[model samples]
Target: MNQQQSLFDVEETIRNSKSQKASEILTPSTRKILQLLTSQRINKVVTASLLDLAGASHEIVQYIVGPIVTQQNGWQQSIPSWVGKAIAVDRLDTALKEIDKGEVGKLASSSEVVALMMPIAFEVPLSSEWTDVYLWASYDALLRHRPFENFKYDKLWEKIGTTPIQYEKIRSDYETLAADIRSRIVKHAAKEGWGKRSSNKNKHPVKATTTESNIQMEQLSLFS
Candidate 1:
């Protein structure tokens, strides 16, 4: 049937696209935890918590893991829920406010300050619309480690607060990442389509190659 073939086509396209992102897999330890999830050696939910905790620094891990492994209560229960909240985050200013409040507070308070998250050094020189797009896309790049949906060239650099010396030192990489990001974003959009979802009132689909997705990613970039 036509629907069956369409599904196969999408599967093939996604498989190929996933291959292109071979560099984006989780770290070895994280991967091992994922394996445990699949193997059922540990509870799937617990494994997710462990993997999420893997993102923390070694000292933090040491402090937390001991209690998690030893405690009889639901110490690990809150972790996966927390990670779920993190990956679903949707605003940058929320992150700023969260950090400003301190990570020792609530679930939203003790948030990860994503690396490569640069301070707003200079005013973004683009138009208001484009400026918003560029910032969101740039943050999405760091959040997802997927370059697609990001700004290109100088727009990319400016959003990340790339210092002058660092920019010059790695200018070539910046250009390369920008190109790849744009291409990926376009390809992702084309593959996902430009339709809107019925469940939401927004004009954009939850995940599409159009401005709606950009808006969503932009919002998420700020939060995550």
Candidate 2:
């Protein structure tokens, strides 16, 4: 199926998933934020900040609703900062390159810019609880308002003058690099024992107290 259709199917599946109630879709504010991000006329920085705001607001929801939801169904929630960092870095790089080539003015709209940013930004949280929630939320948003096809591949190449093969390779490498970074973070967390610390401590005997107690016991024995 086409990208839009696939996204729609994913959304339907998430809506019907056993882990989430059918009514628990994206919040209206979240939808509005995403809509702004997908709008062609919005500034890129504004879009990014909206995304950041959405993330921050979600933290509150996760804190309040997270425990009950997880207890009922063993769900978890995480923000996956590494993924965000990677995407943000990638977008900055792309923007810089486009600016350097004097091609920034050629873009049709911000929606096109976000489309170009998808492969980098399409990341889920590291923990399973957070991952599931993020995936469901993202899938819901994409289904309601698909933005993948807005990327003008032709215009992008025209601006950057890169061949399709080169672009594909770059995209593939970017994905691989991000995956590697995530894997390393996971491994490090595991090796560190999930941030838990050992609770054992050794105590030394008080030599002066021990000697005084022995002398008192000897005096008591002589009196007996």
Candidate 3:
């Protein structure tokens, strides 16, 4: 097929995937954040203000974006071992610090930081089965980052050899894993009474904000 034909065929295939109910829940800022996340290089820092523009919470953004970016950029898997342990250690240390600093409000604007520290939270231990699944899904998504690829159902099932009857099982397993980790982390933070103090620090001053906004506006206008 010609290049144009190939592109069109790919687009058509993507459109045929099982559709979720359309929800108007995502704000414009959230949509923008998703877009930014979808385009980022793995391990790259996406700044707080950019997240503010995207309207995504830190937890949600980290949950969704971290795996994809890391996978695409090539990183370690989530299996329990020294590597996982090391990751867990790092997470713990960071969480403790963030909580002590009362930087909870910054969570919404700091997905990369959260992603790095989540596995260490008391509730979300790195060795837990749930953490494995969460890391696995994120890694898988990253590994298969092509716009037209369907990792959720297709490739994932193929890996586990339970594509048909086990599709639900696979999804359930992963969801359980992710949820467990998230719960643990939150609980740990709460138990430690972290995030009581707030930092009034501003990374971007008013002058920089205005300049960046103007640049973003120009880019938007071009697209429009």
The model with the greatest TM-score is 3
**lDDT of model number 2:** 0.28
Best first by TM-score, ranked: 3, 2, 1
Candidate 3: residue 203 lDDT (0-100): 31
Best by lDDT: 3
1-224 in candidate 3: lDDT tens per residue? 33234323323332343142112223333333323332321121222222222232344223221221111111113322322222222332333344335353222111222233233333334554444444454444334332335545446545644322322434665544335444444444334332222220143211211211111100001001
The per-prediction CA RMSD against the true structure, in angstroms, equals 19.4, 26.3, 16.4
Candidate 1 clashing pairs? 90-219, 90-220, 91-222, 91-223, 92-222, 92-223, 103-110, 189-209
The count of backbone overlaps in candidate 3 is 8
lDDT of each: 0.29, 0.28, 0.31
The lowest-lDDT stretch of 10 consecutive residues in candidate 3 is: 214-223
- In angstroms, the error of model 1 at 174 is 21
Worst 10 residues of 2 by lDDT: 214-223
* Tens digits of per-residue lDDT for model 1, 1-224: 33234323333343344333222223343343333332222222232223222222222112211111111122323222222223223112232233334331122111222211222213224454333333443444344433336536445556467432333443444444343333332333334332112221242211211111111112112212
lDDT, candidate 2, 1-224, per-residue tens: 43234334433443344353212333443343334332322222232222222222222111111111111111112322222222333333333344234342221112222222232234422453333323333332333344457655335434334332332333443344333333333343344333121210111111111111110000101001
Provide the lDDT at 16 for model 2. 48
Q: Which ranges in model 1 have alpha carbons more than 4 Å from their true place?
A: 1-58, 62-111, 114-144, 150-155, 158-224
